[model samples]
Target: MKYFIITGTSRGLGEAMAFKLISPEHQLICISRTKNNDLIAASSHLDYYEFDLQNVNQIEALMEQVFQKINLTNADGVYLINNAAIISPFSRIEQANSQDLMDNLHVNLLAPIVLTSSFIRLTQHLPLEKRILNISSASAKQLLPGMSAYSAAKAGLDAFSSCVGLEQGVESAAVKIVSVYPGMVDTSLQEQARNTSNEALTTPDIFKMVKDRGMLASPAATADKLISFLLGHSFHQGAVVEDLFL
Candidate 1:
């Protein structure tokens, strides 16, 4: 049995992942700004928490509550998926306010860092495998005109994951940090981004390229790959992995 913690469970890729991972043998902790009744009702093994990713101050307390509820300790192998994020509408650099940028960082970058830190502290003595997966975007690799802030934040997160992977390896911890690009899945976030701005919008052709040629694999497909990686043979500490595009 595996213990899984997934953020941004209210919708999009997170929601799909939660549903796909639910089974009689696994324990799932779903975290999001809001609770989805369908997800809560679907699995007896599932636990739901409503958390605002933008509120960094409450994360520790929330983690404590989650650990207490799940009876998790250092002995349990834990898998954390930092999947929650804010995308377009607030995507553009010049169009975004300081508050917008901060909000994006709070959820996309800062919250994950804190949560990973807490997880490391909690599992430092555990004998089980510990994994941290950061959901990234193709925008992180290049200059995305309207998605400057989002891209920047994701790039920072990718860098952070790489550094964490290296440091954890040095410490001989079982913790592995992986930054995965989930590609363009069919999600509300994409729909929202498409409708939000007329200027600097990603054309359908670009979206198709992401889905077909880039890493935008289907949510179910990506979830399967992720589960395989998480549950199969263990890897060395601090390994950095990207989901294969092909």
Candidate 2:
């Protein structure tokens, strides 16, 4: 059976992705901020763990406990999706608060790094195929005035994935990694854009682009696309990619 370890599975794209991975043939272990009772009701394959990513320092031990349930020798493959993130307190770099900066870094980037490290270490001797998919954002590449913290975190994730890929290239049976930009989904971004004051966002019109212009992608559709990407092919190296325009 396949094993999927997903973060931020309580809501948004993370929740949708978890739902798709649910099946009698697979086991899904979720690490999120809260319990998803409805999701748990949906499948016996689902296992839930509640812990806020903001407390990034505590994840390693939790992961160790989570990994104990899986027998690597019996699994077909293992996948990790680091998908929890929040864009809050949008502000210019100079105006950013110390605690918020630290929180964003912990949730958006540091958690994934720590999780990936644990996954690698725990499964180092196993023959199982390992894959880590990082949910990335356009904000990483685009210039959004008030998104300094979010942008830097994602950009750092991208660079980290790329470097890990480079290091794994020559090694035999190294884990496959990818940083995917799942275009504007009607996730929290929609609400933030519609609600946040224009003065806060550097590009205030982007809110209109997502909500008013009807450009936001559906979270379920994006999750389907991501699952397809994960299952349809073997990714050899770390890649920064977007959902293909089909």
Candidate with top lDDT is 2
Question: What overall lDDT, based on C-alpha atoms, would model 1 receive against the true structure?
Answer: 0.76
Please write out the lDDT profile of model 2 over residues 29-49, one tens digit for every residue. Answer: 988878999799999988899
lDDT per residue as tens, model 1, 8-60: 98987888889888888678999998998898999998999888988898888
Number of the top TM-score candidate = 2
Q: Pairing residues by index, what is the TM-score of model 1?
A: 0.87
Computed on alpha carbons, the lDDT of every model, listed in order, comes to 0.76, 0.84
Q: Score candidate 2 by TM-score against the native.
A: 0.94
TM-score of each: 0.87, 0.94
Candidate 1 wrongly placed segments (more than 4 Å): 72-76, 89-91, 170-172, 200-205, 208-216, 234-240
Q: After superposition, which runs of candidate 2 have C-alpha atoms over 4 Å from their true positions?
A: 170-172, 198-202
